[model samples]
Target: MSANARTVHPLGERLGKVLPPLMVLGVVVAVWWAVVVKTESAIFPTPWQVVTGAMELVEDGTLWEHIRASLFRVGAGFGLAVLVGIPLGLWMGWVGAAYRTFNPIFQMLRPISPIAWIPVAILWFGVGEVSPIFLIFISSVFPLIVQTTSGVHTIDRRYLRAAANFGVPRSVLFRQVVIPAVLPEIIVGMRIGIGVAWLVVVAAEMIALRSGLGYLIMDSRNAGNRYDLVIAAMIIIGTIGLMLDGITRLLEKLKTVRWRYVR
Candidate 1:
């Protein structure tokens, strides 16, 4: 091979990763613009109309307020889920009796949709931030518990046996051996949980409360038939969710857990 063929350009590598998505996005926008122009429909917005709608929200400062409220609910709910679920899952996995006792209850509740809890949440928390927060929590917690417990159960028995043979204390064994082995799975669970939390918060805000992107979409459509704003809200929600997942994926690159990510 030529010397040039043996070397890779950083800029070219980055462009290789970036160009395909941009090309697809361009195609999508072109098709959307064509459809709007051909149909002459007032309800279905062109790409430019959506941009204009987003700019309007930015100018009024309402966009940031809605984003902040939605993010706060997701963060609070998902944080609570991580704190509670990890320890409970670890205990259940480490103890056979605890696993049998709690596994059935979790299985029963896990299948229930977060949207189904909206009415009860409103009744319990009475139509405020707490109601939506509760809904996000329920949506995220089950997946975390399931994933964490499974991770612990799947750890190699040899590791535990080695630790025991070395006369390691129970707490030390768990802290050093068990936790490091499961860290990757915990990060995966958190990624899934946060996505679910984001989804639930939107629906919860639509039903139980106001002042989020969900509310913006609903209220804009109901009050003014503003399809542009509704679409803008959807785009914002998707973008934020992608960013959240990207943050969690960074954990896979950390040196401590990076081995688990090796193909």
Candidate 2:
């Protein structure tokens, strides 16, 4: 195709991509507005009402405070999960016997819901940030552990053999060959773990905490009827989650785009 045709094609493609998401968002808002109208109750505020409530919260500094609290929990939980999960996963992946011996425990824990562990988490860590952090950790650990091990196990044998033939030390081989080869997997695990971390953070906040958006929602419910604030908080939580996922996806693309042509 000619350069002019290629340029036109890109414009069409970009519009095609942009229009769908915009239309979907529009449809969702319309449905939400319709439901609120049909209900015709202040207890079920419309989308515009929620947006105005969100702005009011923003002006009063309440939104920022809640956002900070939620973000702190996410960071704490995600940091802990990454620090512990990645190393353990790498170890399990690189060693066969270790994988066999320890995987069963992980399997048992993996099926346990974060919400189910709320009572235990509170008992063990108390009703503080630690309890919520523990919940986040539980939610996030399995994906990293499973994915990292899978990635490590899937490394091409020829890569290992080539490294060994060069008399590369075991430590060096892991650092140079194995880590790089499995990085795409590690990033994938991080993506999944980050998602789970976000999911658990909201639940933890609602159950164990006095601040954050989750608490704001519960607090609104208790204050005689602020469904507007409740809906606003939910929107904020969803928006932040979407932003987090997008960031991780962009990071993954940046890390792995160069490997696209590899067979």
Candidate 3:
């Protein structure tokens, strides 16, 4: 096949894959429009009105400000979780004794909801930015730890045996073989943790901080001038989440592309 033909073929395939979701999105918007037209409720603004509100907020820089604040918190919290959780999980996964010692404590804390920690966070951090940021970290960290542990434990026993047979050092085997094998899992964990961080950060902001998308939604509700902005903020949040997820998928594809021909 010609170069152009090869490129166009994959492009067409990708477009085909994307079309169904686009169609579903269109149908959802249509249903939303129909509902708004039929009900005319003040609480349920039309999609067009929400779009207009989104535009107005963007033009006035209010939307960006809230988005920036939320992003900052999410970024900080997710980064911390990834840095700490991944290593700890790897250690726990690699060593039986470590896993035995830490797994119980991790299980004990994992079930606690992020919201449940709000009172303690506020008491500890005093309703400052730290409190909400800490809440985000708490919500996101456990999933990463669990996933990372699972990833490490799932490594093929044969690979380790082969490395040991070849006189590869324990440290070398882990760094070169074990780490790479589990990287995909770590990335998956990071993606999930980021999503949870985004969710918890917004809730934390709504409760503890004076600014962010969550705070904007609360403020708009209190003002009662327009509910459309609240919906707009929700759309923005969903879009951001999708974008973050897309990045993770892209990374996965990049890592696995060479392996595509193996099987």
Which candidate's lDDT is highest? 1
Query: Lowest-scoring 10 consecutive residues by lDDT in candidate 1?
Result: 201-210
Q: How close is candidate 2 to the true structure, as a TM-score?
A: 0.92
Count: clashes, candidate 2: 0
List of clashing residue pairs for candidate 2: none
Candidate 3, residue 30: how far the Cα is off, in Å? 1.4
Steric overlap count per candidate = 0, 0, 0
Q: What is the Cα-based TM-score of model 1?
A: 0.97
- Per-residue alpha-carbon lDDT of candidate 2 for residues 1-263, written as tens digits (9 for 90 to 100): 87876675778889998999999999999998998798877578888888888999999998999899888888888888889898999999999999999999999989888889999998898988888888888888889999889989998899899889989999999987788777888778888888888888888788789999888999888897888999899888899999988888775556443483255
What TM-score goes with each of the models?
Answer: 0.97, 0.92, 0.92
Report the CA-based lDDT of candidate 3 relative to the real structure: 0.87
Task: Give per-residue CA lDDT, model 3, range 1-263, as digits (tens).
Answer: 87876675777889999999999999999999998898877688888999998999989999889999999888888888888899999999999999999999999999989899999998998977788788888988898999999999998899899889999999999888888888788778878888888889878877778899989888888897578998888888889998988876676665543353244
> All models: lDDT?
0.92, 0.86, 0.87
